[model samples]
Target: MDPLSDILSVLKLRSYVSGGFDASGEWAVHFGSHEGIKFHAVVTGECWVAVDCEAPVKVKAGECFLLARGKPVRLASNMAAEPISLQFLLPPTHDGRIVTYNKGGEFLSIGGYFTLADGQADMLLNVLPPFIHIRNEPSRATIRWCVERMRQELCDPQPGDFVVAQQLATMVLVEALRLHLSARDRDEVGWLFALGDERMRAALSAMHASPGSPWTLQLMAKKAGMSRTTFATRFKEKVGLSPMEYMTRWRMILAADRLTNSTETLSEIGHSLGYNSEKSFGTAFKRVMNYPPRQYAKL
Candidate 1:
């Protein structure tokens, strides 16, 4: 398989937001939830982030956090400590505007928002500890450089700097994820480790290559060179879904994309995805997505 294509297929570039702030203050940002992922970096100063949880998380410079499920969250400086200068990243909206605040002080920071295009991204997300701190470590030099470049872009505000900054910030996010994966414990077992396994990887490849295929536990187990019971147990333990369940999710994901990007008839899409009829596909799609395929397609 083409690793590059595999990587690109599972990852998507969203939007990046970076800024500097002086003094302690609150900033409100508006972001619509998409079936995507989000990564935030505290490039400079120190701040606190609160996301529908009790209290806030104290995040220092060079540290990063991810909201892989695209939940809405709030970020602010730590008022209890010294006033923080801060910067952040987020996914771009249709208007290309990021909601934020600068309370007039010396602060520098950068942030990027991205979507996981493939299953690999989900693997990477799973291995990351709640918050990955990259402070005062030589291994974090690359992250430091990304932070510095973001500061320069914010300070200079040159032509197209906004675009350039966002692109670089996305790169930084990807690199950070790569670093995290490399440093993860070898004994760590999760969907990520499963994906790295030759047998499991091959199984996943088959499923993704043909979500509509009439997949069976025995067939999948044979493909993975394991007993059916072992394959089912292992697949469930790692993926949190049965093989058939995962196939359904995958089909829905593809259906959502097609609904948004294509003009195919519902019947055609349903049949292509292995549904016996458009009505059956529509029923399953609604059960999973809470909207009929045709209605969802319009959105």
Candidate 2:
């Protein structure tokens, strides 16, 4: 897999809920602080979205937004419409989980929340803005398709509608991240954006492809076709971590996954990640994960 896929694949999703909401007649709803990421697309009509106390942005049909972490969000037809807590406004789910408020029909949206495994989402979220607003554009037709299909899955229940909708939710998330990376400047710094950098990609790809390989600064620099000093400085600037530091973090994240899900012994897991001894691997794991392999397994 590519770097983005690698990171996203490692992120364990606990549960996901996919559905649509409909409202009409001077309606506003306050979505209290939520866990994981909440995403939505305006299927028809427009709404004012205020997130984390930031100024409200108008979202028209065909546009979408991703809200990360536990940010509180408010959506309304107009600010003049008093906002009610979502708890009060949300109608019980339909057969496929569509909900409604007020008269329900003038404004419509399709959305869902992903409950990622605790601490797992930051793997992807760290490189993203707290809130991402994707405007409707020729380049974002995928978003439109995904939203439309999601609406179908929710509006008409099927045997596997839940499974299909969850996958579509993940697809939207990836598209949003890809859009963000493409729009960023070359000088932008973040592991996700750095993956898109032409000059930095080779070196990062090498590390991802073979985490167990012996790697030195000169070697990594060579992969990037640069001198050690230049590559180190440039990589740090663009990726927000020295090459080796990034490698260790990546390796530890892999190890954490194995520790939680695999039956391998500490030494086996460590050796697979290039550590020669259990002690050395445990030391590195503690530094990165704050827990030894045995202890972390129970978590």
lDDT of each: 0.62, 0.85
* Total backbone collisions for each predicted model: 8, 0
Pairs that collide in candidate 2 are: none
Which ranges of candidate 1 are over 4 A from the true structure? 1-13, 22-40, 44-58, 67-107, 112-142, 176-199
Residue 146 CA displacement from its true place in model 1, Å = 3.5
Off by over 4 Å in 2: 92-96, 185-187
Top lDDT model: 2
Candidate 1 CA-lDDT value: 0.62
Residue by residue across 1-299, what tens digits does model 1's lDDT show?
32223444444545565354333354433334434455666655676665554357777877766655555555565434432222233224422332234544433345556666443355445544544444436777876777677767776768898887777777666566656555666566655545655787678777777767788889888888999999998887766678777778668767877777688888888888889998899999998778898888776
Best candidate according to TM-score: 2
Q: Residue-wise lDDT of candidate 2 within 190-277, one digit each (tens)?
A: 8888878777888998889999998899999999999999999989999999999999999999898888878899999999999999
Pull out the clashing pairs in model 1.
10-117, 10-118, 11-117, 22-105, 87-109, 88-111, 89-111, 89-112
